[model samples]
Target: MPGKFVVSITCAKDDTDKATVGFVVANAAAASDKDTVVFLSTEGTRLSQKGYADDIHEEGFAPLGELMASFAEAGGVIYVCSPCFKKRGLDEDNLVSGAKVVGGAKLVEFMSDGVSSVSY
Candidate 1:
């Protein structure tokens, strides 16, 4: 069976460095042929929006937008926290490709199986 990789990100533009690194790891997992999910919560939920990641780039790393697009191209999932998204008034229609607003139950279901998780 394939390995499952989960990356939980709780910061968005508020902490671009952490978010960028988290996606980099997630891309690596997906590139390794694992089932990868980037679970975005709190401030991180904002990243699910189209163009939100466009301006974020950390030194010595790929731009956040490019990393995100590559992750999606490599079959990674971006799970946005529903409540957090709504609380922040984000538009679901504008979510980036491969991203979906989901509840905690959805995350629980994904983690019900044996998996590795990292948080940022």
Candidate 2:
């Protein structure tokens, strides 16, 4: 039983609370020694950009940027939606340290083997 956790977030600053909580869950999963991946799509693709998460802070939670950093530091993977990123004209060079733009198939492959996933 491989403990793989997938947190799929479809909102970014547009829905700070959801995005913030998503990263929070990712952090927890990573800390618990689970293989964790955060799949960012739609507006959430913006979070893959360095500094885009910097100003997001939901009440009663750590700052969004800090949560994202912690999750990465804890060995969490961040998969950004390729098409969504390109649609917004985002620069690949500006991706955050642990984020990579990928097609949906990448995510499908990760979950194909069985995973626990939650969406925000």
Candidate 3:
């Protein structure tokens, strides 16, 4: 079975640096053959919107949108927190590629097997 890795991001436009780096790490894990997941919560759920990341470009890194797209293209999963997303009134129809709206139980289930995780 493949090794599992999780990058839990809790901020988006509010903290673009963290969001960018989280996706960067997620991409690395995915490229290294790990089953990578990026859990978006709090303000981070905004990133699931199709055009939300379009203008965020951290210095010395690819644009935020590109990083997210690359991570998904590399087979990484993006888990958007259901409560947080709903609380923010984010558009479900505008969800980006590879993003799934899920509850905490889903997160727990995925990580129950001792999957390694990081938070941003």
Candidate 4:
């Protein structure tokens, strides 16, 4: 089987450029036919909320929400950190499409077979 690619994101707002890039990379990996996942931790969990990323448009790139939606639409899995989400008191019922709240074990399971990972 092809190797899986995992992106561990931990940023928010404009400071989340690297995290955004990590999603983009995961999207690219999926486009290349690899299994890809973006694990949102810390502030990155905010992106999993409805309307949170709506107004965030990065210059020279698609809107953050759009990019994220596209990535998920294209089969990129989005895993939001359970503790992070709870710490921020995010509404679990309002999680965006394609996003799931999971514990660290889920992430570890996905990458257990020598999957490659990049942190943002």
Candidate 5:
């Protein structure tokens, strides 16, 4: 793809709004046909675990879990920070759809091609 987009989210239940809207924007990026990635770091790594986002439903928006699923269905990639995941003791076996645990180098590599990025 000619265009690449990155959405960097560092909060999860600690900030439901950011977590939810991040994926909302990710869905938009995916629909726009950009090579989109939602990088979950810090507290956001918890979201990579199955059922972690199931209960997060922001006001006037779809549930976080559904938003995430649809984002993956739209071909969006979800990158969970390896250090953060291990720091939180999150289970790799329970990773949600489209979610992959990766190191900082991976994120840097993806964005090395002059990609656009947003943070929350």
Candidate 6:
């Protein structure tokens, strides 16, 4: 069976370079036909908000918003941390397309099947 891949992102902005890299990897994994999910926790949950990544164009890379949209369109799952988003006072009604607000248990459930994970 194909392996499952989980990407855990915890950054809030373009300055947090690791988050960008993690998203890139997750996109690749999804494209590779692996079961892929991106867990947005802590500051990473900010990306799930509509327009939050709109102007975030990292040098030498695709725009973060475009990258995220492409990943979701390609059948990758985006799970935003519910508590983190709530703590940051984000608007759930304005979530980006293909994003879901879920608790840690949801993430745990997705990764329970011996999934490979990378954290950023």
Poorly placed runs, candidate 5 (over 4 Å): none
Model 2 clash number: 0
Name the candidate that leads on lDDT: 1
TM-score of candidate 6 relative to the true fold: 0.93
Question: lDDT per model, in order?
Answer: 0.95, 0.93, 0.95, 0.85, 0.94, 0.87
TM-score of 1: 0.97
Which residue pairs in candidate 4 have backbone atoms (N, alpha carbon, C) closer than 3 angstroms, thus clashing?
Answer: none
Model 6, 1-120: lDDT tens per residue? 367899999996845567678878988998889889999988898989998888877777788888888888989988999999999999999998788999899989988888899999
Q: What count of clashes does model 6 give?
A: 0
User: What's the C-alpha lDDT at position 117 in model 1?
Assistant: 95
TM-scores for all candidates?
0.97, 0.96, 0.97, 0.93, 0.97, 0.93
Over 4 Å off, model 2: none
Per-residue lDDT of candidate 5, residues 3-116 (tens digit): 999999999999999999999999988998999999999999999999989889999999999999999998899999999999998899999999999999999999998999
Off by over 4 Å in 1: none
Residue-level error in angstroms, candidate 6, position 59: 1.4
lDDT of 2 by residue, 1-120 (tens): 348999999999789999999999999889889999999999999999999988998999999999999999988999999999999999999998789899999999999987999999
Please, what's the RMSD in Å of model 5? Answer: 1.0
TM-score, candidate 2, is 0.96
Better of 2 and 5 by TM-score: 5
lDDT of 4 by residue, 1-120 (tens): 467998888887846567567767878888888888999999999989989888877676777788888888988888999999999999999988889999999999998999888888
Stretches of candidate 3 exceeding 4 Å from the true structure: none
lDDT per residue for candidate 3 within 1-120, as digits (tens), equals 479999999999999999999999999899889999999999999999999999999999999999999998998889999999999999989999999999999999989999999999
Q: Of the candidates numbered 1 and 4, which has the greater lDDT value?
A: 1
